[model samples]
Target: MKLPEINTATPYAGLSPDLVLDAVSHCGLWPDGRLLALNSYENRVWQVGLEETAPVIAKFYRPGRWSDAAIEEEHAFALELAAAELPVVAPLVFDGQTLRQHEGFRYALTPRRGGRAPSLESTTQLEWLGRLIARIHSVGSRQPFVHRGRVDRATLMQAPMQAVLASTLLPASLQANYRSAAQRLDDAVAMRLEAIGPVRQLRLHGDCHPGNVLWTDEGPHFVDLDDARMGPAVQDLWMLAGDERALNALLDGYTQMREFDDTERALIPALRAMRQMHYAGWIAARWHDPAFPAAFPFAAESRWWEQHIADLHELADGL
Candidate 1:
């Protein structure tokens, strides 16, 4: 049967179940049933349900946004993360390989993992999420487990700035529907970008914006491992540090998973700055979209960057 469509994409506009099922049949992991819903987040994400069989997720890599090798790496990372036995989204393999080429793009299959997104107001549940982050960071980087090969902090800081500059120079809105907010936001991100600095680098959930997360029975279950990269432990903490209770609660919660000292606790600022920089970059990149908010999309206002900078009365606070 024809599969449901995947949403949020420009690349997979031509994809259908023909190439997908054809490829899956060859790989031997095709679920023996009809289609379900289209994943609004994944351009290639589709739900396949079979007769009395477990549901499985199918995804195809859209061209341009990602290369075959990158998708290949993502699937491999999911497999390794699964083997590490962390409560993570595990990828199902075909012919022992997680990624395969289909419809002129790459594709992979993984079991349908279930979980709800934790409510922002649920302090206890949020703390539980923190504990999960600590556990992920605790896993020492092993071969084939490094989040991303080249996404270090310095690199992290540059991307958002570039996207902002590009946004600023773009042509004006149509029919004179001027976007004052977008233009002002472009400036805010530009001013905020330079003040960011280094943090305690480790493995980061590269894009930890709240949307990619989920709430599971065990606690918080992280999804969309697309941007998982090697960077700082605090990288995950940046967007989270604004709420003091959540911040402190997370620090306390992490200990349940692994050990960190006062020195590490103090590193929250630098890590947060890096996160803001990336966030500012994202706003700048998508400023053209009407949904893009002027006061930064996911985190606090740009002034938070300045406030963070001023909070430092002394030299860099951590080792």
Candidate 2:
């Protein structure tokens, strides 16, 4: 079967090595040709060694993903966090702008930062991470995003489900079952949000899973704010803790810096449900990209759909 047409093949199909080198030079930096592709699926990122300076990370934003305004808002947010002496990797100000462009691609250059993945198993570590996130949230709440989006059901649940249904990836035999399960999940998520009415929405690190945080001897610092959005503070905290103990530890550290709304804890299950649906939709929408097939081979199998439907039903049952 011919795969569905994707807008562009994985957003980096034409990002050749020389193109990256020229982009660096356009920014007035001399490249040493020692380029290492970083592990990023949403955008193309590379660590390029410089001629007379240390290596720097070049992130080429995926076309059609975020408008230039939204991306600049992200860059400004990072710079704001850094100005507060928070451990965040902000983009370098080249010429006069943090956002730069080259050969039809919008990109930014950040000084290469090195650190190991954080160990979430330690309570102390969790607490430390909690404090940092709280600090981020504190800054995030100070102002609202003019261009970035929010973490809500319309974008998270409805859009993803629509994409999956429109795609050819779902088998004809399983489509009905998947649709029913997903619709039920959508209803449950809506009800959950209604029950937790009027939670405070603030600027958030929208995707705060451990992978986004880099840890060194000094402490933890966030590396990616690409998913930043306006949402409840808990949206940043819930993903850090799987169990009550860990959650409490994270909260323990967070409270030390800023007051957290305990009521937001109730929104965790709802947020998780939305994420589960959003992930499947994201995969379906990107299935036409070559990288999607290689990284998500299971998505092509009937067994995966079976599990996915069942999981959706389980989420509905809980809600």
TM-score, each model? 0.67, 0.96
After superposing candidate 2 on the true structure, give the runs of residues whose Cα lies further than 4 Å from its correct spot: 1-10
Candidate 1's error at 181, in angstroms? 13
lDDT of 2 at 156: 96
Q: Tens-digit lDDT track for model 1 on 50-117? A: 44668777776544555556666666665665677766776676667787665466667777777765
Worst 10 residues of 2 by lDDT: 1-10
Clash number for each model: 6, 0
| Best model per lDDT | 2
RMSD of each: 7.8, 3.8
> Ten consecutive residues with minimal summed lDDT in candidate 1?
310-319
Q: Write down the lDDT of every candidate, Cα atoms only.
A: 0.56, 0.90
lDDT, candidate 2, equals 0.90
